[model samples]
Target: MESKSYLPKDHVDILPCMAAFAVVVETGSFVEASVRIGVTASAVSKQITKLENILSLRLIERTTRSLKVNAEGEQIYEYCKLVLESSANIFRVKDKLVDNPQGLVRMGVPKSLYATCSKLIPGFLSAYRDVNVQLVCGERFDFVTDSIDVGIIVTEKPPEGMVARRLFDVDFVLCSSASYISKVGLIAHPSELAAHSCIPFVGDLDKQYWKFRSSHENCDVPIPGRYLSDCPEAALTATISGVGVSCLPVCLAIDALRSNQLIKILPDWIYKGALQGTAWMVYQPGHHVSKRIKVLVQYVMADLSRLSTTWKLM
Candidate 1:
């Protein structure tokens, strides 16, 4: 099969114009995007119009007082983000040599692991005195759209594209507060959970079926939860208050387990087949990796080695 070449023509001069169009669409108004780029609103409007003409399609729908990006424009905006960031990184590469491990390193981490991972950042900053780090800590994240330098995501599979550095296992633990277990008694089997109170986080998966696996067997317990949340903290708080049992990452529940604040259930069975099964460090493997980013990743990798082991619930 013959592969068709991309960029068969010359659009080099209009790349900046595309960027301008992107900003207007992203900011939802030419005025706001112009303020951001330090340009006149009319100039931004003109650039977008030029882009629309070149593409032979309407990118934005503008009323007297409002602006909206059409479907085509929204898709282009995403590409513009990648192109602009890649262009910016090229310049950042030149600055890397002199600065060494000094500059801003944008990182994304699950908010649930912040408490566990936050310790590494302070040590990294102290060692690289000139480097400053910014973190986007949250459950929901988008590396490309959000401009995340690196993202630590807990999932059974890494994202399909970009680049990924497999970090370690993120073993899920079926846990509850010690008080809750004392009242409800210990869960002996995965199937027994159906009769007990449970807390589940809401996501794309089948929420009613909680899965567990053993050396030779696997089971999906039809456990129901009255409390459903997107935040791990909410589930943790609920579990702590003796509300229900919730599956949590071992890293998030480490302190609780160590302090006897939380109790692990069905120790013989693995909290398997759920979405949160492993940890991966994901990023776009562009041509250049800044010195600061390299150093930070090194530090993280060294520290994260300890996290790979099958979690000890003690």
Candidate 2:
């Protein structure tokens, strides 16, 4: 098939405006496009208008209620996607010449990982002084369509169509404040948990059964709790205050365990099979991998490894 020709060489300077026009078409409004592109609505509108003028075509029919892309506009938008992507690749190539990894690296991580890694991220930025990192912390798996460069997720299986690298395996343990254990009595076995007041993670409680395995035996115990919360931090805080025993990621409960503020229950028993949680570093397979992304991934993997070891899960 013969390829359709684009505009004259002189029109190349309007590439940014053309890109903006494509975004507006896809988003159906200048305001939405502006939000996605991190630009003002007025600026996005002006750029789209400029592109329309350059092409001498009414690409979009705009009204107060809606914006519709014309046939020519749709074609241009399709071509512009390729053009903008190629242009971005050119800039990325040129950017690699700098000695330091420098650019914006947008990363998505689970809220729990964010809390633990917040302290370590600054060290990475210090090492690559030119790089600016944007960390979006959420529990939802929306990283792929959200344009996230890297996603740190805890899952048994990776999301479809993404490249996933195993970062680490996380272990969960039953933990309680030392004072609480001392006051209510120490829990030496899994069955003893039924008698203690427990703070269950509201999000996972419906899945209900907690499993444990020792050298010779395995058991899945039904868990009952007096309090429940969706936030891991809140649950940890409640456990720290001696409210109840909670099943927690060992990493998150480390400091309390070391200071004798929290005590682990049934140390011989393992939960959730061999893996309590699997941390996977995932990214879109064909997306551009900039130096900043490469460095950030390496740094995070190393940092998480160090943290995992410190938590005695190595």
Kindly give the number of clashing pairs for every candidate: 0, 0
Over 210-231, each residue of candidate 1 has an lDDT whose tens digit, in order, gives 8878998999888778898876
After superposition, the stretches of candidate 1 with alpha carbons farther than 4 Å from their true spots are 1-97, 138-142, 155-161, 203-206, 307-310
Q: lDDT score, residue 20, model 1? A: 86
| Cα misplacement distance, residue 21 of candidate 2 (Å) | 29
Q: lDDT per residue, candidate 2, 212-244, as tens digits?
A: 789998887777778877666788999999998
Q: How does each model score on lDDT?
A: 0.78, 0.78
lDDT of 1: 0.78
- Residue 120 accuracy (lDDT) in model 2: 73
Clashing pairs in 2: none
